[model samples]
Target chain A: MSTLPLISCRGLKKIYPLSGVEVHALRGVDLDIERGEMVAIMGPSGSGKSTLMNIIGCMDLQTQGSYYFDGVNTSDLDARELAALRNKKLGFVFQRYNLLPRASALYNVEIPLFYSGMYGEEVKNRALAALSRFGIDELADNLPNQLSGGQQQRVAIARAVVNDPLVVLADEPTGALDTTNSLEVMNILQKMHIEQGVTIIIITHEPEIAGFCPRKLIMRDGKIISNEISSSDVRSKEV
Target chain B: MSVRFRVLSSFSIDALKANKMRSFLTMLGVIIGVAAVILMMSIGQGAQQQVLSRINSLGSNLLTVMPGAAGQFVRSGNVNTLTLKDAQAIAKLTGVARVAPTVRGNTLATCGNKTWTTEISGTTQEIADISSLEVELGRFFSETDVAGISSVAVIGQTVYENLFDAGVDPVGSEIRLSGISFKVIGLLKSLGASSGGPDRDDTIYIPVTTAQIRLLGKTDQSVNQIQVQVQDLNQMGTVQDEITSLLRKRHRLSDQADDDFNIRNITQLQTAAQNVTGILTLFLAGVAMISLIVGGIGIMNIMLVSVTERTREIGLRMAVGANKQDILNQFLYEAILLSLTGSFFGIVFGIAGSKIFSHFAKWSTAISIQAVVLSVAFALIVGVFFGYYPARRASRLNPAEALSFE
Candidate 1:
């Protein structure tokens, strides 16, 4: 790994179209996330971090400025290109876990593989492998509601990373879980970063949750207020 | 397209599984519509067949030349005449097999206190052979009676029952009609009813000369109508053509002048009847197609509701890299699958309905294979057509907004 930034945004802007008005969701944003780095984005509601996370995830297009993912200029990409990038490179985890209701854990994990252009038994094998990695293979036949909140988030994470994407973008992955479940989910994200060498981004307003990431990006009033080391792990590794 | 179709079928199966009751109800609409088409076609076909058979019982090779025109009002005092000479000329033509002159009228006949009102027809022995008659008693009027104007009559089955209440031998008995007496020659076998509602077996066949001279007041006049039979059934049309032209020439009419006679061929009439029934069947099938369209609309509606319900799923799929085309393909496939399933059930229902209708309603049904194929194809097209907008709406949805929806 040459330490190339997996995701870099320059002067990003997001303007919400209201009824005969423009709501400035993000005036400008600049971000850099290197490969193998675990980053946390912290902000209060309406601080534009959600908007920033959306842009980084390629779930929504920006109104202005450029974003680069794996050296490819994302701002210039069309809708199809954005979809391809999302499937091939980025995995998403929402606060609700966002597993398809009534779908089995195996099927939930197989979703990306289904869309990843994989065919036949390969999709099933890959999905099974991904579920086993998260230790949810035993619950592969269980529905989302059948699993515990923490287990559901683990299944969601397995689903997100099944395509072996460049990054796991989790937006408050533990927001709906209890303290114990939240800790379990945070540990899962940490394992993906530390053990599997997968770059991970966690967006949250809690410093305690942000403490688990090696790097933290804090946002306030549509701007990055702090971009600094949050843990001693990355420094020790660097030395 | 294959992937699209697979996705569509899967979604349709899911919809059916999720809302089994609604899916079944939707299928009912298509079933009724398809059934209606076949039912209507069968009824029309049955009527047409009845008409054709009625004409067939009249003998396939017979042709009748009437002096009255269709759709024209006749002046009562001015009688339209078709001479017996014209009948002779037609009888001499190359394809002519037989010819008979006839006059029709009503009169009272009495034999020993048994009196009845009946039709008295004046014709020769050829009438017996051409009309497929079987003599119940005695014998038919002969050539000698026709040539010599013998006062003899052959009564039908109904005339025998009414006039012979005494159980006397009708073959040798004398009957008085219109104050004129005639010896019974023979009795005709039954021939049921004609399309005109007159009992064919109720008429009395009298020698033409005797009918003109003894019973009615016509002492000397050309025969009123002539029935010509051709050598072969197929030659009837050509013979009729020749007869018409000959009649026109005999009448010394101008080129523009309309002929005073009408030549009706039973086969031609039967063909016309068949055509009418065929058209009616097609029209019924067409009406059924409309119901199928309505059924397709039903499928579209349910699919649209399904798409709305699965908005979040759509968003999730989009996030997982499903493009607009993929989304479009998925929903479109869903629509087509629904209609195809409906079509399958519709065909089953249509056949069953037709069978039940024919048995209960006494209708005749002919289930054409083409109808099934056309119906299936139509349903699929309808699924696609009606399903298009909803599928498009689903594909056009923004992932962010959809994901946020409950």
Candidate 2:
């Protein structure tokens, strides 16, 4: 087994100009996530949890920092390299599901594979398999609008994991769902981490949802305030 | 890795299909622009064709020697400047094939009880050959008729129709021109009315000597114009220069003076007509291109709006691993597809429009394959030119900010 962590960040800083004033979304943060670890980040609005997710997803670059993913320094990579890294190694689930409204559920799942330059029948079969893994293969042809909130979230999850990425980042993945739907979504993420040995990170304010993960990190004002490992009973009981 | 052409196209097609009405409206401008270009080109070419055929029919190798300086308007009293002797001199030139001097006068003709006013042209038998005029009923007046000054005439189709009943045989009949009775020896074939020109079939032909003595009351052998046919088309310029110097010498004009007669080359007139029509066609095409540009602007406008409306989708795609180039290609393909499809229907509409126009306007129109190809090429250029800006804007969008955009 590789001793190097899947994700390693040190002194990460992101300063953006908003209306001519410098706003520090992420100020000097450090973190490490090992392979096959399931963690949850809890924070209020403007606490930089979303900023951290964006950086980890390879969708943005830190103004000042070094990010190492899979033993490669991400700070030295260009935009195209970052995009390739994102396509091959990272998966993302949004708060709103963000399934393309006009695309079929199967097509939504095929997007990551398509961007990774895999096409034809193989892409279709793999997308179908991902949908089947989430038990939504019957809804493959249905558009996002035709599916319920929980079903749509399931489709989004299937899309994120379709390429078997090294890490799955869920940013308020169940924010729009009811308590029952939220628990169901968390259950699927937990199942994927345990069964497939996939690393999963969920960002949420709900302690009930965060309880599903083995590790929880709470953030405030652009820094992690608490990092704790909850008892196995809290994680196992939720599943 | 870049997306495949097929995949990009399918993505754009789906996006276009999702908003059917908006896509159609965006294409409407290109359709109208292409149609206008085609229709205008057809009309301009039709006019050129008509002019060329008309001039060709009058004889391509022929020149008209009018009794006035070139580009100067001639009054009716200026008829004495060119005479039959000048026509004889021109006929003797090396490149000249035939010459027919003619005098024209508008006179009333009365046959039986019917009276109609028409133009009377006095010329020799060579006029029939030079003008390519065929006799439908009887032979044209013979050379003997001109030498003897016989009171014989050849009636045109329009004059015959006006002076006598339709069923009547006007040949071997008598018609009075300016109160002078003449025997109708032949009937000229109908040449039909030319656009914006005089009716060619509404005139009468008679022996020049007879007209000079009996009707025109001219003691001298003065004629209005001389028609000359050249043996070869290539010798037109040399022959024209020869005629100019000969007329100047015969008229006793000094070296500094312009010749009293104007030698108009039929080929030069044809070329000038072609140039005019070419400019007209270009002007029309330019106007149509402006509309095409406007259509391109319309595409840019809608694409900008589309980028804005689909910001969240773009963000999502980027998050899922799409780079700037992928996003750029997607939107570019959409714009190109809209223009290409619009141009296709535009070609159909243009062809149909020209056909309908020609049918009702009594004008001829021809749609060239080049015009179709050119419009399509222009549409493609427009698509690429206008689509680039919006696509770049979409591609430059920051994924994180875009994802959070409402």
Candidate 3:
């Protein structure tokens, strides 16, 4: 594999103006992640982990940063260009599943495809194939509310990977799930990273949840305190 | 792009259907506004048409020469400015088809013990053709009768019912007019009521010479009015001008002085009535347009509430790669669908309401296609105008803050 990183950020900083006072959410952070790597970010609340995730996801602009995704400078893109990049190259999974309550599972999985200009039976077949990867294709016609927490999460995962994005950023993906559902979700993420060569980044406060990844970064006071690689999960086999 | 548009529309439709009652209530204002516009325009159009047709039914090429100055508000009864010689002079004009000098009086008619008082009009034989009068039972008196000063009368339908027995022929019967015995020679057809408040069927016609010599007892050749018919309606203005000049010259009136007579083309009154109706319709539509604006405001209010309620959904879509324009298109499409559906139902109701109004009020109503098309276009514009703000508000939301909102 090439040595170029999938994501690289240098001296990233974020500040918010609140009530005529400046609140520094992130002072400066530097990070790098290789392709096909499964990584986790660990932090307590208000530790700026969420802020970093938002900037890396292209949903927001950092106050001061030099960030590159696949060697393209993010600051060079406009709002619409950022949206197109998000549509084509990135995916996200949230803890709450964030599924449209009224839409069927099949339609929920089809959201990214819809934005990518895909139509007709190709869209349906791709969404169905994504759902089948998680063994929930039979529940495609069911609404989000009709499924269990585990099934809903699986559908959300199906949606996140339906477009075969370059990287998947999950924010507290297992936070709202029970132990059984959480383990099942983490296993699915692991399988997606290993089998499909998809780079994965999961944020969590739980050490056991972070244990599922091969590498983990701990953040405090808007700065990275530790970056550790687990000795047992040396499973970086390229596809 | 079209596929994305389809997706957005489906999302809009689904959202609207989720709250069916709210959607319908939001549409109510547009419905009523469009219906009112249609109803008002139809009523105005129908009244104008009816008035014109009534005036036309009197006679298409007819003009009345009244004994007053034009545009005068008040006048004394029976000015005696017109005479039979003036009618003869007008009849000699180039485009005059017929001229009848008219004399009017009120007197009691008695046949046996029954007596009823009614109006009496005196004219020559040309009055029948000029006024569109028909003899239902008998014949009109001849012009020779007028020349000989014969005391022959034609009783109208109302007079026949009042003075003569029912199912009995009144022609050739004698009826005393103000104690002067006259032969009833004909029964005039029923002409119904004029909009000017006169019962046209209640009059009796006699020879102008007879009325002047015997009944009215007038020494001079004065007449109440003159009725003139022209060969063509388009020539009425020229004929009127010619008669004015001729009369002015004969009367020896100067240019600075107003003439003592007024010549009214019935078509002018028809046009005036039409103008009044048109103004009334425009006024009503203006009021209805206010309500349509109010309805648009109602749509705006609901869309604002919808945007607030669906904040989380908007955040989710944005996170999933939907852009600002996508969010805008979704909400805008929802609002447009609501208003357009309301307009469709409003058109159906407007037509039905016009029919019901005409049936109940005994008024004529005609729905115009122009009104329908204009109102629909207006309603669509209202939807877009009102829906734009709320959709913009939705599109401008911060995805991070919106997602974190409860």
Candidate 4:
């Protein structure tokens, strides 16, 4: 890999003004994540984890910051350019799975590829491959509401990596699942990391969820207080 | 970009299908508006055509001079101040081609065991040329018959049908009129119902001399109306002025006497009627356009609701890779599809509705291809105009806020 970090940010800050009162969500956050690293950001409510995720995902503009993805500065891009950058380089998974209610799982998985300029039968094939990788290709034609929670998250993950994005940012990927389904989803992410060398950043408040990631960052009051690397690989195949 | 647009359009159609009933209800306004406008426009055009055709039958480049001032209270054909001498004087005017003096009287005619009441128009041989009256079979009165007061007549089509067999020639047949047996010398072709006037085919023509002295028993040389044919249509006004001056001089009428005559320019009246019909059509179309606007508003209303309801979906699409333009295109296509679909059905129903209306209402309706094209084009304009705001609103949404929205 290149010497430059895969994800880097300096002096990131986000502020919101509500009816004349200033609410600072993130204050002077600085971090660097290397390539092929599976990391988890663990923080309680109002800890700015989701805000940081949104900024890193290029879905929102930062009030004051410099962010670089794969060594390209993000602060210099316009809205359309930022969208293009996100389309080509980044993928996101939300806590709720955020699949279009009207589309089938296969179409949901094809969304990122569509943005990445894939067309027709090729897009369908890539989407099917991603769905099968998660062992949920049989449910590809089912809508989000038709699938179980675990199946829905599998479809969401399939969508997140369909374009082979440089980094996948999943916020609370297993937040809505029971313990049995949660472990199943964590195993898929683990398989993606080891087999495909995909970089992933998952945000969660559960310690159990954080334990699955090799590296964990604990945040409090909009700042990371601790960054830990565990030597023991947590491998429990529940599927 | 083209592929993206295709996908977006398909998604728009899918979105519309998701709320099938709402989309259809939104399109209802456009359908009714287009149908009503086209129907009224066609009917108005048909009426104008009918009036113009009726007026054409009176002959081209012709003018009528009657005895009194024309007004709402002044009825034609009763003024007795006009005379055959005045007609003769007008006939001599420069630019006047021919003149036919007419003295009309309702008379009863009996042939064999049949009797029918028809107007007897006492006119000279020039009446045929001045009034576009054609002799379908046999011949009109010769100059010998008119000058000699011969008791010969030409029967109109309705008169021939009433007094004789359908296919039998009535030319050589003799019929008794006011107890006088006059030989029918000609058969005039049919002239159907005019604008609001009596059917021309229901009249019988006789020599003016015979009707004045032998049948009606009038000593005064008076005529009801004089039909004058001008040499050129462009010289009508000058010919009319010349006739007015000649008649005034011959009658020894003073300047204040109002000419004791009225000149009717049939073509002028036709043009005036055409203009009135055109304005009426425009007025009706304007009212119908109001309904189209209302229909567009209905589309706007529903699209706004749809955009708001699908906020989360929009957010998800943006998160995946869609830009603002993609969202805008998808919503705009939905609106356009609804209006265009409504317009198609509107055109079909408009044509069929006009046919049904004409059949039962006894009013003529002509569906012009321009109207169909214009309605469809206008419907497209309405779709773009009303659908833009909602689509823009959907596009301007912040993806982060939208995805988080419930």
Output the better candidate (2/4) by lDDT.
2
> Order of all candidates by lDDT, from best down to worst?
2, 3, 4, 1
The order of the candidates by TM-score, greatest first, is: 1, 3, 2, 4
Better of 1 and 3 by DockQ: 1
lDDT of each: 0.81, 0.90, 0.88, 0.86
Candidate 1 clashing pairs, residues 3+ apart or interchain? B8-B333, B8-B334
The most accurate candidate by lDDT is 2
Which CAPRI level is candidate 1?
A: medium
| Residue B92's lDDT in candidate 2 | 95
- Model 4, span A13-105: residue lDDT tens: 988887999888888789899888899998888888888888888888778988887887888777677777677778788779988888899
Model 4: colliding residue pairs: none
Task: Give the per-residue Cα lDDT of candidate 2 at B116.
Answer: 95
Candidates 2 and 4, the one with greater TM-score: 2
lDDT by residue (tens digit), candidate 3, B1-406: 7888898888899998888999999999989878887887788788878877887887878888887687775442457677788888999999999999988899999999999999989899999998889999989999999999999999889989998778999889999999999999999989887878788899999999999889998677788888899998889999999999988887788989899898988888788878888887788777877887888899999999999989988887887788899999999999898889888888888889999999999999989998788778888999999999999999998777677769
Per-residue lDDT of B217-300 in model 1, one digit per residue for the tens? 675445667888789877777888898899999888899988777777787788888888778878877888899889878877
DockQ by candidate, in order: 0.57, 0.59, 0.57, 0.46
Regarding TM-score, does 1 or 2 come out ahead? 1
Indicate the docking level reached by candidate 3.
Answer: medium
Worst 10 residues of 4 chain B by lDDT: B70-79
Question: Alpha-carbon error at B15 in model 4, in Å?
Answer: 0.9
The runs of at least 3 residues in candidate 3 whose Cα sits more than 4 Å from the true structure, single-residue gaps closed, are: A1-6, A16-23, A64-66, A71-73, A229-239, B65-83, B92-96, B103-120, B134-140, B149-190, B201-206, B209-225, B231-263, B359-362
**lDDT of candidate 4 at residue B213, scale 0 to 100:** 82
- Residue-level error in angstroms, candidate 4, position B19: 1.7
